[model samples]
Target chain A: MNLVANFGPGRPRVEQRRRRGQTPRAEILDAAGELFTTNGYANTSTRVVADAVGIRQASLYHHFAAKDDILDALLVETIAAPLELAERLRDVREPTPARLYALAWFDVRQLCAARWNLGALYLLPELRTERFAAFRLRRDELRGHYETLAAAVLAEAGGAGIVGAAALPFRLVEMVINMRSDEGSAPVFAERTIPEAALRVLGWPGDLDALRGRAQLLLAQLEPA
Target chain B: MNLVANFGPGRPRVEQRRRRGQTPRAEILDAAGELFTTNGYANTSTRVVADAVGIRQASLYHHFAAKDDILDALLVETIAAPLELAERLRDVREPTPARLYALAWFDVRQLCAARWNLGALYLLPELRTERFAAFRLRRDELRGHYETLAAAVLAEAGGAGIVGAAALPFRLVEMVINMRSDEGSAPVFAERTIPEAALRVLGWPGDLDALRGRAQLLLAQLEPA
Candidate 1:
């Protein structure tokens, strides 16, 4: 007998309802994320997000307690992907520092793309309370995750000898990611210029090569010479 | 003094009234800049600034017109200081690239301290509008000023050969200034770290004890044997 078949009366119905509930919840979050990124958080409203998802604002309330909750969920989902990627890289046996660093970079880039509104959120102190604690907590966790990876890379790459006095490559990555998340001006230039700058900072040999080549060179440096 | 004594009837009285009016206008900006930096642009009110200056909110309108106008005045003053400094540096006959770079760093640090809210203003798209056109224009002008300085420094340093990558140093300086303006977290570390990073990126040697020695070495490299 299947485990599903062994369920009591209404249990299957309850499970089906739960799954149904999740789809729209996820849909609302998707719409909210898009709106929050396009319009500044202060300017975005609950009604607008509901409209984007083709639902009543009251229906949105059933899923999200408030707009802040939607932002919290977005932050959680946005950061979770990169955190998981970092964890996965950490668990990989015999992973080179370069490979790990590249993974970290890609993870951050993905996070930047997914939650571009985070820049505005980070700038505003008022939005960082109560329900939004999770956003800050997850962000801190992400920073710690990247810091660990950067420390590992530095350890392998002769620790400050390669990156110079500022140990700036790490800071450069952080700055570039922050800059890319900026929606106000020249975002396209930021997106293009930052990755190239990151490659240069990593001491990758070639000038503006394919992403794979750049990653390989950077990661190879983290391996034992 | 003779011309003033021989002036038409009431000219002195009119000039005195105009000067009195200017005092409150300047006072409004000083209060606004202080309030905006300590408590963010959105959180600040013209009423609060007026109260701080011991004037009625309606009286503030007599001096400034609107809140955005006050902000525009503050931003223009904030941006103009650095450009003025750059101009002063330019007048000195062919200041060495190292001196020019150092001056730029010092000028930016001063401005960062004076205008911490400018970072928050730039990050918030809600603040950008036709009303804040002066802010945007001055911001772009500041960037152009940096680019022009970078070009001069690169040329003086004999281009990319001596500087490794001429554009990289300028980018590093920009990153340092940006990081310094971030008041939310690790500001002190960012301030200390970025200037040293800029010096290193400029290939001016990493040892703090040997800053003068390093500058000399860099100059020799720029000037050649």
Candidate 2:
């Protein structure tokens, strides 16, 4: 069960007037984010968030229209950091496939773990309602950004001829992220397993020490050539 | 929610005498399997399965102790076919990595789609219970078989030194199977995508037609000298 699945919907909603210098909205969002992460989206209720903040549920509603609104806010904040990193990596001059692959993989891993649903909610259609469309669109946009970054890098690295090879890095990264989401295993298992698997796919020497050094070398190679 | 979740310790047990001439047990299982596939495991109940077989719920209970037993039976039947196939494939003399990988990919795809709950059930903790441990153990055994097949093929192909290379084919196949389990996409998409992805990881051309011919050629290359 996901953290979101544990919280039942329906919380008391009492509006609270903000003081001249305070941001009650931010407080409500902060509480919701913690609950969603620790508990789960499904199991969390607005009342829980309000109670955590020592505010009425109505005040929480005043800050956000629904529980999904809280989720949307969390997603935007959570996903934005990695999306920014991906964007910065895309701007690197003469990017090599290996370098770009590593950057994107690392970025997605960081973002996936930070989000409570681990990005599955964005991909799951049953969860994709009109309210959640913005989150989905943002997620898709980030995906496209990563794909474009990969394509550019593959082209630079002389591996462009392989059909879907450019997109393989992104797909592999997503696969690793999904594997980490499995309840049976610890994230450490994936952390060890995925990079080795990915390095092999990228045609690197799969030795961890070699991979780390070679990844650095590949990044250096991508510098303004 | 799973059928197993609906069954608790408080439920009453009833003993029944078995009649050799009447195979009500098998009939109920057959009906339940069909209903579970079409209506989903959560939506289908013991009563529903009983109705399909023209029997009362009590008679259904006479065959299987609970709905979870029905699920366990279905899983055992579902997973056994694929394990058998893997064993048969493992016995093929002089298998190449490409041939072994392709065959494994095709076999896993077929099995993943055939058992509607196999992937989803893996996500459920109830399926990991002691009573259902056989299902998981069988799955692990099958995975070990595939890994061995891949390692043997890689060793024969003289590419064992590629650094994590020995583990690549198995990881690729596993990733593809995981993707196929996602409810959003069609099985055909994964079937096509995974093999091509596997070929690329194996350092083969990614074109599907090219892969088919190349896999055969690679197998021939691995034949005993």
Candidate 3:
């Protein structure tokens, strides 16, 4: 069943024709992402993912030892870019609203544009198990960043924030995942409309039109070229 | 496993013992709701549900022809009261914002207070199949009510609604499911914070405290005594 093989031990270059990624690992993730999001994580087997990628189950194991590993890898991929952006945005010399808007914009774009609706898998009860603790912690860290930025927005508005107010901006961004689930895809306006709504929920009395322009500039400067 | 029999045809009261619900049907739904929310719908078999309820598999089938039927029943249960409330709230002579807040308040309360986090099951990929079409339609109708009310709120503010603005209130209320999943429960502040955020996102240029008082009165008057 080997389409191509690399001459190495343990590193077995079993490139059985690229499917979605440049490597076998990527192909496995692509297949698993589809199955986990569509057929469900509990119902999809490692063998099914291997078959979808045209690789032997053992070869699939060479990259990811278990189905959980594939899921973990996919989850990490979703948050990695945004987490990095959130980290970088923290030090940028921009207004709090602009920074928050940029983070929401980047996050919503990724959630809506991903090949699979991976965020829909976030509620998989399996995630509660200890195996996914690292993923959970990383997600929490991302949420923490959102809270910090949102708190700044509330403070800038000179309004004492309501309970859970800081959390709403993050939640507003999360709505795109459910919206995508229902509508088959996110509406084109989601990228703009969601960020604006995020700021509004914080009672940001600043000019949104001005905020949007600055946020777009920050994104253009900070996003990887 | 039967503890008691109902003495009827097709309605065999094989009520071995009640776990949560009083009737055999209600008992099945309770067990299924727990299993589906915690263990996941795909992994929980009808036999497992019956075992948990101390009933025979045959008895379970007598009540629900298939597993999907049980899921459909549970999903319908989650939406039934809220949908009815939304319908009743539609004609109430309150201000548009108060009606929207009340709808969000009622919806979020149920989502948080359900015996099980049944709303978590809403994302199951199996739900996309034709078997659950009725549930999907019913849920959509509920969303339509939210959108109509939200549109009125936006229009009253004279802020021409942004694309997809009307859908945010429903999405905001829906966030409680994910919040519940993350924290293992929704916090006490969720009911008030979420609905307020829903209105804030729509730029409801009105006094929230006054609106809250009105919405609470509406709930008191309209919700069954």
CAPRI-style grade of the A/B interface in model 2: incorrect
- Which portions of model 1 show Cα errors greater than 4 Å? A1-39, A93-104, A111-118, A127-131, A152-171, A174-225, B1-40, B51-54, B94-96, B151-192, B199-225
Q: Kindly list the per-residue Cα lDDT of model 2 for residues A178-220, writing each as its tens digit.
A: 4434442225434434444444444443245554565556445
Give lDDT tens digits, candidate 1, residues B116-144.
44544555554445777666676666556
Q: Over 4 Å off in model 2, which ranges? A: A1-79, A96-99, A108-125, A128-131, A153-162, A181-225, B1-67, B70-78, B96-99, B111-121, B125-131, B153-171, B174-183, B186-193, B199-225
Worst 10 residues of 1 chain B by lDDT: B1-10
Q: What residue pairs are clashing in model 1?
A: A98-A219
Which residues of candidate 3, in runs, are more than 4 Å off? A1-18, B1-18, B160-162
Which candidate comes out best when scored by lDDT?
3
Q: Model 2 over residues B1-225: C-alpha lDDT tens digits? A: 222221223343242422222456666667776665445555578998876765567767877888989988876765575576556556666335556555555554655555343443343334545877777688677667766765664455465333334444444555543444333333454555555555444444334565556555643443322
- TM match of model 2 to true structure: 0.60
- CAPRI level of candidate 3: medium
Per-candidate TM-score, first chain only? Answer: 0.63, 0.63, 0.91
Candidate 3: chain B TM-score equals 0.91
lDDT at A66, model 2: 87
Give the true-contact fraction for every prediction, in order: 0.14, 0.08, 0.81
Error of 3 at A83 (Å): 0.7
Candidate 2 docks with a DockQ of 0.14
- How many Å off is the CA of B27 in candidate 1? 5.7
